[model samples]
Target: MSLREACESGKFVVTAEVAPGKGTDVEHLLKDAAIIKDRVDAINVTDLQSSVMRLGSMAFCHLLTDMGIDPVFQVTCRDRNCLALQSDLLSAWALGIRNVLALTGDHPKLGDHPTARPVFELDSVTLLDVIGKLNSGVDMVGNELKGAPDLFPGAVVNPGADNEAAMDLQIMKMEKKIEAGAKFFQTQGVYDLDAFEKFMKRIEGFKAKVFGGIILLKSVGMARFMNKNVAGVFVPEPLIQEIKDAEDKVQASMNIAVRLVKGMKDLCDGVHMMTLGWESKIPGILDEVGL
Candidate 1:
């Protein structure tokens, strides 16, 4: 069954992501995906992740579909205008991809190509709105279409916001995205389970299906980097110290991920894994967590 069907059936879903490289060879991406294909409900294809130029998300999603895997085709508004965005959605549907994750991508300045122009023609909310329109047998302007896409659209969320005000804004955006037709959400990496639990409790009324995000803590440095640079992601110092003190760092990282997954058992609809480059270790994490 597709990821949408899995979630609708009240199954606690599991999802992961795979990013395309700047160059043409996809052998590595495919091999990694094939390793964890059966373990994940769906695999998200990143769109020029971090705003760095890379192989197309749509193309890789198509490849996943051809390989009999369900792919969450990520569409970032930072690279495409509305016209192009709608066009690409239809193209993706024609290519047999159903799941989509809408994102307002990072700025090009944060990427390898700082001089490239950025396009914020539509943010995540607006993009979700456009997807709704497409599903309803029309384009963004209310024009009729010969064929409309039956896309299972999802969006991102940041549960570990820095402050109360930021958390409030995140909730507001989550509601707005729901109104705009977001059926599910995959949040940013979270470490503090108590804070994440509090955030989940506040949104209990929405009845939304949220997949709590998990990033394997590779090292103390990685945890610190995410905390200092990434917005809405806070890695508590205790967890950092645990990584720093570990003699077997890889096993320690897997154990940390296992704990995070176990913590979300009663809170979220599922968990979304963003393992960075540690994709092959997912099975071990899942097995350890008894998922």
Candidate 2:
């Protein structure tokens, strides 16, 4: 089933993501995705994650289509204005891409190119509205189109935010995204299930499907770093200590991933696995999660 169909049908959808390398080398990334083609409903191609420049998500998505794997094209508003955004959206449709994830990308100052300028003319909410207009056969400014793309657009959320005001703002944006035509949402990394369950209760009335994002905790140090640096994602101290205490860190990490996915199955519509470099572990993880 298409990702959209799976989400709308309430099927326990599974998705993974891949970030392209710095150079033109995509063979490893493609190989990684190939292993999970049948296992995941779709694979998300990141758009300049952390504001790092790499191969464009649109091109990588087209490559995925060539491999017969569905791709969730991630588009961010940090680099492009409205015109370029619409143009790229049309370009993506022409390349046989049907799914998109709109994001307000990280600032260039956060990446290798610290001096680069940012163009945040549109945030995630307005970008969703642009997608709605395009889907309705009209441009952002009421211009009509000879053809329109049937894009199933989604957005990002942070249900694990520990801060009250931050969580409230996330809910408000969630509502705006839905009104702007977001069909689904993929959350930030979730390590604490009780907090996530509370978040689900808070969004009980939302009409959009939510996919709980699970990132593999590769090491105790990685967990500590994220907790210290990442704003919304929190890796609980116990889970961090569990990894630190384990002799086989990789296995422990996968175990934690399995636990998180299995725990979230009933609480959310799906799980979006951000496996980082551990794509090889996905099949085994799914097997552990009972598929």
Candidate no. 1 TM-score: 0.98
TM-scores, all candidates, are 0.98, 0.99
lDDT of 1 by residue, 106-135 (tens): 999999999899989999999999999999
Residue pairs clashing in model 1 are none
lDDT of 2 by residue, 83-139 (tens): 999999999999999999999989999898888899999999999999999999999
* Model 2 residue-pair collision total: 0
Which candidate achieves the best TM-score against the true structure? Answer: 2
Report how far off residue 36 is in candidate 1 (Å): 0.4
lDDT of 2 at 273: 96
Q: Lowest-scoring 10 consecutive residues by lDDT in candidate 2?
A: 158-167
